[model samples]
Target chain A: MKATGAYEPIFAGERRKRLDDVFTCYPTKRAALLPALWIVQQTHGWISDEAMTEVGQVLGVTAAYVKGVVTFYTMYHQHPVGRHFIQVCTTTPCNLCGAEGVVEAILEHTGCGDLGATSADGRFTVIEVECLGACGFPTAVMVDDDFIEGVTVDGVPELLGRYP
Target chain B: MGYPHEPHPKETLILSKHFGDAGARSYDGWVKCGGYQALKRALAMDPADVIEIVKESGLRGRGGAGFPTGLKWSFMPKERRKPHYLCCNADESEPGTFKDREIMRWTPHALIEGCAIAQHAIQAEVCYIYIRGEFTEPIAIMQAALDEAYREGVLGGNAMGTNRRIDMYIHRGAGAYICGEETALMNSIEGRRGNPRIRPPFPAQQGVFGMPTTINNVETLVSVLPVLNEGAEWYKDLSLGNPKSTGTKLFSVCGHVRKPGNYEVTMGFPLGELVNDLCGGMRDGRTLKACIPGGSSVPILNREETEACLLDYEGCVEQGTMLGSGGVIVFDDSADMVYQIMRLARFYAHESCAQCTQCREGTAWTVRILERILRGEGEMKDLDLLLDLSEQMTGKTICVLSDSCAAPIVSGIKKFRDEFEAYITGAKQPVAALT
Candidate 1:
């Protein structure tokens, strides 16, 4: 089973070491699915079906077991996205601050809404999400991984324009 | 221009009356301000009386569940052989909810004092604060306050010279949202994976090493301190709305609004006034599109319905949604229902504890279908499937997380089916998802 992706070599050895540490942390190997998926996603940008199967094998569980976890949570992405994954907070707190407009602005600029879809030019993929714990800064969106607070419809183009 | 800042509609609750410097987690500072007097008053009364007082005050759990605080405390098995436990759920992970963190950050003593009162009432010898791992700074603040309590002979064994003994400790979770669920929080405190357990043996009966446990949210517990001090009558009068729902609630308003911060407002206040007047109206003069009155878990409210909705628990329920954690997210005209549903689905998909098969698979299915639709690759049947899957997922899990995830998808489709249909026809892309 060609479980390893092309990007695996970048952190293959380190991933293996982290996998071992994860096993030691938990009494049961099956419990390590989340942390292991995090490590793989950090290394590969997203979790592929192949990566899930590989993680299941290393943890002595079934591919279905890992897939159940990977798919259940929003943090893990299955397909590749843009170099920068922009997740705007569309939940109630952020929505009150024009989170929807900020999302619209990003989508208009990027042309992709799902987590894995990239823009035609491969610049960005805008994913609208619930609250990001920064409700104080409403209409907040996380660019790549850093939170960009107080984003508005007009401010979105200026923000993304700088990324490329 | 930057978003406008609205002054708090009411005075701060636990953060009120800081006599000295802003940073006062020390025992001496809290004592000078009459901190543990409530604990003294609580200990002097019959434990049953304390419970009765809270029950009479109509204080609901500030935790997302909104269960009756007094009723929850009274659930302890009186004849249970093992010692009862009070687990303070400081694991505040809900997306728009941050009131607990602010309480812990500003008035850690309020939580510590609240824990002492709960321990006395429940007759529990030990209490543990289960905080989220990401709250590194707030955890330190809690620890310092706890340590000061210990130094002053207030926390460990024979707290405040009462015959009863209560000890408090801090346990940090490894960042799982499910841990916010009471049973899952108990499991994590016991050093297990943060997966939720089934109710009916609800934490009140068997919890934390097979002993009786009562889990209370940080804000809920802190509210008790003042309720005990000023008496239940004062708390009941603090409400600006229905008598059943008393006291002030910290409404965390965000999105599209000019001022988006935590505003403590009386229950039953008009939603329109709070949004347009309090939040300084929608930014850039955009038209209001929709809103999620509570946290993301509750159903979304369209512009017409939300305009009439009030910022209280009953008001929201009357409008076919809930005041879940009081996280109000607003949206403007540029907002797209299709993209909004997809984003919310992704959050539920990511946070499912995976204990129950239905919630485990159902959340993922919701996200996958939403992902396909947002990609402009949706079929008409997919919308029906999204609704069907959401129905299957609700109330069929160990925790409410499943229902929380499914509610938005069901509501999103019900309220915005046209948006989904429009996407299929390739007529107009939602402004929010227009890339």
Candidate 2:
């Protein structure tokens, strides 16, 4: 969570303006906490302790309060991850299909070797997530921002290649 | 019409009429398909009359509870006292429901029009469509459509020359299944943890920001367009004999079906036909083992009950399940009941917000016991213990999440006692350890 060199501010210049625009949408600055955290995550790969403090300073909330909200939601990454974060749906609907096989294939091919671990090559991180709300397309996987449908075990390599 | 499959002859596609059509995504494309006429009509009519029309159509909420939509809108103060808010619950994360995702991606304007009409009816000027963050494409599509609506005079300070203000924005949910709960959704919108608040002073009385608010599902709001376009009775005629459950519901069918997609069928449609015909039956000659007629929150149905059950509110209740979100998850002979039920419990356990001790403790324990049974390490008394815990979990929380976790367990043990007993008696070998 600590910065390597210097802790540059996240809400500066254009990002600050974007946060300000979102502030107008809400009656209070604290109400923009989720959107502000999203901006931080979208800019940096993940949220850090310093970044949480900066966001709290902007919204007039505390770093501890920001951490509580960030941890409550799963998408807000609290630490660093691989370049491409992969979430495979293993809920029952997908599980009934070959979703486990898909997850296993992803883990083997990505060299992550385990769920929630970034691959040694630092290209991908794989995790078995809950339903992505796309059940008809079983084995729905989200690589970074793109939500791919009907992913099968055999298609793991190609799905990984597209991200890199 | 089903998107992935060819439209079945019996499907009455009112909401999903333009589902797979790429042209309907554009604002002008939506207008060519006779969109926005409903908003114009709804705007001209008295707001109370609009409520009356929807009530006459018998359109209940499609977001699982199946509460009457018109009755819900009526709860908002007769006059606009303060800033009334409209929350379009696009946070669709139920295990088997994806209808709202398609509705937003395919026909964004349909949702926009529905929101505008609803805002006018409930006298709310600002609406926030709280979509889940996982839906990256749908969120972009909706934002683009909102831009179009604003530029084209369909929304803004003077919407379509009506001189009434209606503004809509998208509040992206980071990742929480519990946000699908109405009260939890408001908390999420306010940038707080997604926790379900206890009800008595309902959303209608004191809602988001301490003002009156109303929330509607994506399907429920889109259904508003048709009832206002065609007369209420014309829409009501789509249902089978049950006057209580009218209009076509989009059932998101998945798991072991040949043609898995959203199938729009009139209420009271037979579940057997939906699985056997509309979805092209069980996958490749596998015999039907069981079906979760609604989403995972409701009870599961065995093969015989699945064959005879009707796809409506009253009918699902008669079969000992609620028509929840119209998500039909099919199971074939090869599927394992004990393992799959364990997986469902795990989902609830992971999603529980831990605000209430009963849910936080009960869900985690349910998963442990179910995992034990799956591992062939369970004793006979564990079955009785699970049922006893399910009783305690059912109604003892701020939300029904604990109750939802207990639903499949209680039902699975009742319908497939042999399955659980097989694991306990060491008659069936334990499958590889559950992940």
What TM-score does each prediction get for chain A alone? 0.85, 0.97
State which docking tier applies to candidate 1: incorrect
Off by over 4 Å in 1: A1-132, A138-164, B1-6, B9-21, B430-435
Against the native complex, each candidate's DockQ, computed on alpha carbons, is: 0.20, 0.89
Quality of candidate 1 docking, DockQ:
0.20
The top-ranked prediction according to TM-score is 2
Q: After TM-score superposition, what is the CA distance of residue B296 in candidate 2 from its true location, in Å?
A: 0.5
Tell me the TM-score for chain B of model 2: 0.99
Which candidate wins on DockQ? 2
In angstroms, the error of model 1 at B112 is 0.9
Clashes of each: 25, 0
lDDT digits (tens) for residues B69-126 of candidate 1? 9998899976647788999998776776766766776678988999889888888888
DockQ, computed on Cα atoms, for candidate 2: 0.89
